[model samples]
Target: MNLETFLLKDKIQEIENGFKIKNGWLLICESTYDEIESKGIYCALIKNKYLEKYSSSHSWPINYGYEGKSNVYGDNSYQTYDNEEVEPFLFRKSFNIKDGIKKYIDVGEEFILFYRLFEEVADKQNRVYYFVNDYGELDEVIVVEPNKVKIKLKYLKEYITMRDMHFFISFEYMILRKTIDKDWNLEFIDKDFSNENYFYNHLIRNDMGTYQSWILGNYFIKPNVSKRSYLDFDNFHCEEFIIGIDENGEIILKNPKYESKGNFTFTYFKKEVLNKYYNNPIEYEIDSFSVSNKYFRLKIDNNLENIIPVLLTDLLILPENEQLHWKQYNIPITEDLKLSSTYYKTMILGNWYESPESIDLYFKHLYNDFNKKWYQKFGWNLYKPLAKEDEFNFKALHLITENNIKSFCEQTLTIVKLTIDRINEKEIVKGIELEPNTKGISKFQKFLESKNMDIPDLFEFLRHLQSLRSGLIAHTFSNSNKECKKALEYFNFNERNLIDIQKEIFKKSIRTFSTLETHLL
Candidate 1:
């Protein structure tokens, strides 16, 4: 028997014999892809065919081309100035499908196209294939000729015999026509399907009630099949029943919607079939990618880094077909980033930013996010915390200020000294001038010249600090109250300056370290 005939008259009749909801298309949830790990589409059936637009709407805060800012919508005088209200479907129109698949799945064309299944339209293509809601439970796909379908289904069941098989029979597709009032809203007037069946009275006759559209969505299992097969429809048979070669491939079924699903069969009526049949997927595969090992890797957003000389930097998420390996890296793969295999190998084999401009922008954004926090963290390490009272705290002049001004100045001086050393192995220990009678200002000047860092103001501040410590601070035991007050006053203003310069020193040092690791692109 034709699947549609068996489904409409016998199968549906058997299922709907005494089922609770008597009015509409009914597909029940029999199983899932993975009960815990898998998240598939399981939605309500019984649609309201006439009412247009879903009650819910989505918002994407990007205004114009800029993210996190608003643009054109405010000028409209209407007090209802909500961005979504002004442009309910703006996000979908603003971006392409690929981008829509990313950043904002619930907005744009993906939203309009994918989400219509959620609303009770019961018709994704405005046609009812199977008159049902598909619960996205089909993980594996098997493609074969129409006569070979029984063997194909059996072959499919073999893959499930050992592993758990999740069968999902969705009943939400049961069509329900509601009684409505002046506003055309559902009045909930209960008309029993127990008496008049939409399947016999309307759908089978090709006279769709009220809506004037075919129900039960459909798709072509063999999208790439030749046109010759379509032209030779007169010789078609029950093999056509399993899969049809149309008798008059193009004469009847005026609905372009009907033309899409071949002549008579309604199995592939919905877009659900296309995702499976278009490529003709076989065994269910986990649609994700992960790094190969336990090594923690950076997942940066730089696509340009792919061409650089850097090694072991960032793993850009790639698509499945684009992947080379998926051996369980520490990175958790999500639908947002399927994580490509080539990108995975590239991720494990890191690269650095070669473009100076890109490096600057990337580092600046990194600094703003967390590198500045690290600078603050290092500043804490450079100073000694002094508690004046139970709840009062103050940072001392330097790492070990109580020892002497010489110790204090030396601590800060090491930052620049160590930085230069880290920047180049040849420069290590070369900056400290150990000449005859080299002391005080002469020594400081020689040191600054040898290091030749971009941070001059920082060294100047360090010099002034050294002077204060050598003169007034070194004699802490013999200092008068007036001198102590003077020292405190100097520290109050200069301490902040010291911290700011340290931040710059840290920024430069970080750049230098990254430079050591990278070859400029």
Candidate 2:
């Protein structure tokens, strides 16, 4: 049979309706809802195929390739092919329903077909589809094909027994079932009653014996005219009675409050029905009540409004009491100066100064010690021979003194020459150019003249002293160690003091350079 021919919209609708009414039979299984919805039109087509076959009482189990099995059709053993031919098809076959109900009654393959149909239907509808057992109980079935027929049936029965089944079947399910079983009774129960109590008292009370309560709960009460008795049935209710007609021709109670005319009739049902109707049936405003345990009654009134305010007040007062308690126990105290003497003790020991801060003071003390040592080592009265007749303890001192003076003069001349070169490069001085005539002394003097700068008198004197110290140390003198020691002391004092002075002078020079650059620019 061509499965495509059965893919009609009406047939799909029929299958959908069948699933709604059939307890536990979901045309759309819960698992496949997302997948089917995502592929909407494609799902609809596949669903149509199943619904059409289902409506015609044919099997529409999705054929997944099956396992090999042999079957005897006419007393001859026919070996079933152990390939795709024997494998259950993933798509349903037209003869699946009849074959499933008949030959495959206990076969593991039937369960696979059952679940496939269930899944296809459930997927298209986007709701959980279920299967029903012979006991009229609804059951949730697994999406996968069952390996054992008994297991599948057991699951179906378990799910049906566990779930709270809905009595009213969907119109689509009824339509499909009607196609197969036209003589099937289609009873429509009235759901327009305000409360189950009224229906129990007035309408379904008489029909209780005819209609069994498949599930237990509050039932509608109605008059069973055929039996001439009041019936209370779980599923059926009556329509509103007209003023002129007997119970047989009366309008079914669709909406009685809207239909009833007289004030007395309307008021009676309104008070008992409309006023009592809970918009949200799940929630209710319960009143305080007393419970009796044996001989005594315990009254419990735990309304939120009455108890919350007192709780809030108690919470607010707790922090204030804690603060007061802390204040009472924690007293403030101050220590006496005598008890904390660290600062005073450090000052008294004279070890209170940081190294960097006392460096200048330390250097001053060192300078004083060096000067004293120098005076003691070499007689301070000894001086450069003012006259040629003065006898010198060291002859080398005179030569060293002359060399030192000459070196200082040469250095000063070099500095002057560099300055002159700079001035010439900048074209700052534009008068007569100074030129040296002599080879050595005249050239040196000329270099100084070009820069128009002179060496300081103090620097010249220091240079002469350095030369004298070098000579004395180099000469074979009786007290050479003494002279050398004195020379070292003098050199150290001058070197240290000069370096410090030069650092200050360099800083000032940098500031002068900045000013000069600004002005020149």
Candidate 3:
């Protein structure tokens, strides 16, 4: 919502003279005041009845203007204020009594007018302009073309004060800084406001500022139009909000909004997807055993359902339920997000990759496959491999350490081998020891070497890694074999070698897998 202000040619001239204004609130219209005076139309204006320091006053001593729709006659001036400034004329000329008059005085161009003290003034037709309104107290607007609504500064100032915010800005690479003086005056420390690079270099480069975090969620977001034009975050020469903190002390991220044709960066779904899609599922499970909890856990508090309203408010979006904070509709926080980055990625991107425009099927398919397999086969066993089974059921339980490692080992190794096999499909080798002629490197390693990739130990490592299953068998046998004594005497058996081999194999498998994934997978 914007405040309204009144103005006329005579009033503007008076303000331009020695008369002062408060908070610099006044509109300057292109049309002559005489035309409006003839109309006897009405309008309101904000005046500089009292010009106090830092209040930014403007004088509007209009001989003819409207305080309302009705006309007023005077050699005297009038004043008023509105966020939408600039427009002209007096009583009869102020506005039309009928629809015709309305069409005549269509405010063609207006400016939230202001003037600099002690500056030279040119003739009216060719005079320079500076938006000296309440919003631009610190700015020196040398050329405020009709195209720009400079009053936005007032709205911005209001926002800052009302919200009690802290900020840094760099609009489209233009350095813009705002600071408060000891007298509570908001001013700029612009070393050279004329030079864009000076601000960029000083604030962005030297001052360590960034706009990557700016997004729609943090601000009083609205459709980019009129008063909302400031929402066009990516508009060139536009101010970029580098950082901000809300009333709740949450970190406000900067997300520069770029222009798009008939589309928006953020979208809302009418309902949650209670129905799961079966076409290509993203199978993701929480990695409770993960070394880094951040990768798996949701950073938000566990009271997710309860906090959605707060999030929506912070995001400046309409909340689903304002009274949700009160105990009315009970929505449980069912799934704990402390599992993996998979959920966040998929959930965030799902909207963009949805139907209608199909550009990234290949990548999307891979993503779905990875997540599906992760949830379906990997994360289930991550924290408690073998389903909490003790050293008893070797045949049934997954006797491995981590959930995904075993499958990862198998999958990565297969990819590595398949890649190598693709390059050497027709070759046959006769070997007695792992390699026919080389130093214990397998065909896979040789293939990578030929391709000028780093060689990895494959056969040798797999030879040891393959012992895990056997080690499990031995452990089972050693634990409860009915003929253990007889079997030991006959085979001269000791489970130590198999046990040792299994441990080495596990280590080697991890190392080999990493190398293969790096070189080939």
Q: How do all models score by TM-score?
A: 0.18, 0.13, 0.18
**Candidate 2 residue-wise lDDT, 1-521, digit = tens:** 12221122343443323332222222221111221121111001112213323232222122222323445557575755333212221221123574463211122344345443233233221222345433232434433232211122233322222321111111111111112223424243422222322111111111423321111111111222232111112222222221221222221222233442322221001011111111221222212211122333322211211110011111112234332221221111111111112222333343443211112222223333433443454333111212333211111110011124343333223222222212222122234354534322234333445555344432333333333334442344344556445544544544554334323322332332333234322
How big is the positional error of residue 252 in model 1, measured in Å on the Cα after superposition? 45
lDDT of 3 at 246: 34
Better of 2 and 3 by TM-score: 3
Worst 10 residues of 1 by lDDT: 390-399
Worst 10-residue lDDT window for candidate 3 reads: 212-221
> Which lDDT values do the candidates have, in the order given?
0.27, 0.26, 0.26
Clash count for each candidate, listed in order shown: 44, 55, 62
- Write candidate 1's Cα lDDT for 393-453 as tens digits: 1111112212234534444444433322122222222547467875444443454466453
Worst 10 residues of 2 by lDDT: 266-275
